[model samples]
Target: MRAHYRGWEEGDGPLLAAVTVLGRTGPQVHFDGIPLIGRPVTAVETDITRHVTDNNLGLRFASRGDLGLYGLGVWVRSARVGDTSVSEARIGAEEWEEE
Candidate 1:
């Protein structure tokens, strides 16, 4: 998984992001990025095996700043069962705003 933060300003606070797979003892990874000072960050867990039961994937983001007008992009790549190649297909995307 990869995450990118864009349009960061000078006063914006650093953002904390984490990814977790349900039933797992710990998160896949947790990272922080400061606006105007951070680059794209990637997290990988190669030991995770495909589960036969239902599993939940979680994403969490937090910051002390108001987070005004910033762009966040997250990409998750995985290979299909029995497929050796990974697909770059995007599942969905949307824009949001707060009043």
Candidate 2:
């Protein structure tokens, strides 16, 4: 799925925003997409560690994954868009690397 979020904040020359994505599955899945704040979206595929029981999937920045409590996944990325930011996230059950 492609997800996008937009909002503006006042007061600052440099724009900043944070984006998070989560996914869980029993089989191999790829959490890929461009989490950005501008046009010409770039696709970024995240390497997800597949869990055994319940297939818990988790993602974090510079942190140990598989820390989610309920099979929930979390990935945080920042976009320097100057106050307003948008995200284009896509999730699929197929291998995105092969595509």
Candidate 3:
């Protein structure tokens, strides 16, 4: 599954956000097209990471098909637009799910 968040606006400068994920050990997490966690050989239950971008933030997760009963939970810890703190923005929260 893939989750993309775009909350930055004009003159926002740089936005920084943090997210926590709860899932099985097999899921891979990526931020801004870069691998952040979920190494193939390591197993972990949760991941807390941060990302900074000017206008767009991208989050992606990948797992093997054979892993049955797949589930993932994402929590927005905090978000900042420039120097102002803003509420968590989930414009297309449901878009993360597969059709």
| The candidate that achieves the highest lDDT relative to the unseen native structure | 3
Superposed on all Cα atoms, the candidates' RMSDs to the truth, in angstroms, are 14.4, 15.6, 16.4
Which residue pairs in candidate 2 have backbone atoms (N, alpha carbon, C) closer than 3 angstroms, thus clashing? Answer: 15-82, 15-83
Stretches > 4 Å off in candidate 2: 1-54, 63-76, 88-99
* Prediction 3 TM-score vs. true: 0.19
Which candidate gets the maximum TM-score versus the true structure?
Answer: 2
| CA lDDT of each prediction against the hidden true structure | 0.25, 0.29, 0.31
What 10-residue stretch in candidate 1 is worst by lDDT?
45-54
Q: Write the per-residue lDDT of candidate 1 for residues 1-99, one digit (tens) a residue.
A: 333333456798544342212212212322222111111212121111111011333332324211121233332333333424232211112232111
Candidate 1, lDDT over the whole model: 0.25
The residue-level lDDT of candidate 2 at 72 comes to 30
The local distance difference test score of model 2 is 0.29
Better of 2 and 3 by TM-score: 2
Query: TM-score per candidate, in order?
Result: 0.20, 0.20, 0.19
Show model 1 residue runs off by greater than 4 Å: 13-84, 88-99
Residue ranges of candidate 3 with Cα displaced over 4 Å:
1-24, 38-99
> For model 3, how does the per-residue alpha-carbon lDDT over 1-99 read when each residue is reduced to its tens digit?
224444577887434332333222314454335333333221111222233223344344434211111123332222334554322211223334321
